[model samples]
Target: MGADGTPTVMVVDDHPIWRDAVARDLAEDGFNVVATADGVASARRRAAVVHPDVVLMDMRLPDGDGAQATAEVLAVSPSSKILVLSASDERDDVLEAVKAGATGYLVKSASKQELDDAVRATAEGRAVFTPGLAGLVLGEYRRIAKGPDATSAPSLTERETEILRYVAKGLTAKQIAARLSLSHRTVENHVQATFRKLQVANRVELARYAIEHGLDE
Candidate 1:
């Protein structure tokens, strides 16, 4: 934890240079910081040891993706929040990361000041996105508001829609499975189906859609 009672953070990225630099910046900004340069193994270890309040996890790693690794982290410490730090603007990748348990997302090339502020925002329990991407996240909300026919929305079954409501609430596949008395695989399938039907790319968008349409309630 920080001196101000702010939560500590763990920075995970495969790039040693950027990882160290980001860690140093966060430290200067008064965060208790732990950092790693490996994707799968190191990220897990760091999370286990630090149980950080916020995590700045890279989306891509040599051995695994940050999204894939987030589940492991959550299992160890369910209270920890994850924020993706990625270079890709690929829509599907963003959605998958969010669906996988990340609380927020950020793109690389963000200035030092921007990244610093983002870390603070996330630590304070707020969602953050880059400029253009915020619009994309907002669009999903609009799709729901304008109705299923307003956009290229696809039709979903009752079960799938139920799963989407959980997604909007930031529940993982396993959690949803347990809540609905379905298997993990079944929940994953429902998520994929929702992705296809909505003509949307990722969980983040789906979540916004659910919230926008009042599916979360």
Candidate 2:
């Protein structure tokens, strides 16, 4: 969230028209368009100053790919959540962006409403992905989990495990709170604790851990 409570966003894309158009759309949708950047360098530089609540990132930039831009921006503004708005839904690209610390992934073909919802969810610390891409990401994580590192998984409290199951099933913090008869903040706290314990950066990774451990059911 921004200083004024509106979610602040930064648009990073190489094309001026697309960049400006996204910025305009977000502004019209009630988000504070704090800054716009054309590539990795500008994104990093501007993020350090604005520290936006969300960043709408384009995969192809003049200087580098969105994965690099995502990593750089988060390095400067760790609290900023990145939502990749790209044309390609290729498996490697999605996985790379997620590995680079992006909080969500949305194809450029998504409806404006979907983009709006995704940005809002990203700001609120939810992992958003274009429908099928999420399964692909989860599959990758599942395969990786079969490796030797899977044996050292961390343990969680019963309440934390219950919340993790909800997270893996794509329930938002608010929804989980309602289902568990707990406060929203309490749900978020448990989610954060799960994140810390699992050594995962975001909900996507946490969900992966849950699925790998058969907790998604």
Best by lDDT: 2
lDDT of 2 by residue, 1-217 (tens): 7667899999999899988998999899999999999999999999999999999998888898988899899999999999888776354665567767776678888888988988887888876644334444444445544655564445557787676567666776688889999997787666545434433433334333222334443
Predictions in order: lDDT: 0.66, 0.74
Candidate 1, 123-169: lDDT as tens digits = 76555544333333334535554664444444567786676666656
Off by over 4 Å in 1: 131-217
RMSD of each candidate relative to the true structure: 11.7, 5.3
Candidate 1, residue 22: how far the Cα is off, in Å: 0.8
RMSD of 1: 11.7
For model 2, give the 10-residue run with minimal summed lDDT: 203-212
lDDT measured at residue 62 in model 2 versus the true structure, 0 to 100:
87
Error of 1 at 168 (Å): 18
Model 1 residue 101 lDDT score: 67
TM-score of each: 0.62, 0.70
Candidate 2 residue runs with Cα over 4 Å from true position:
148-217
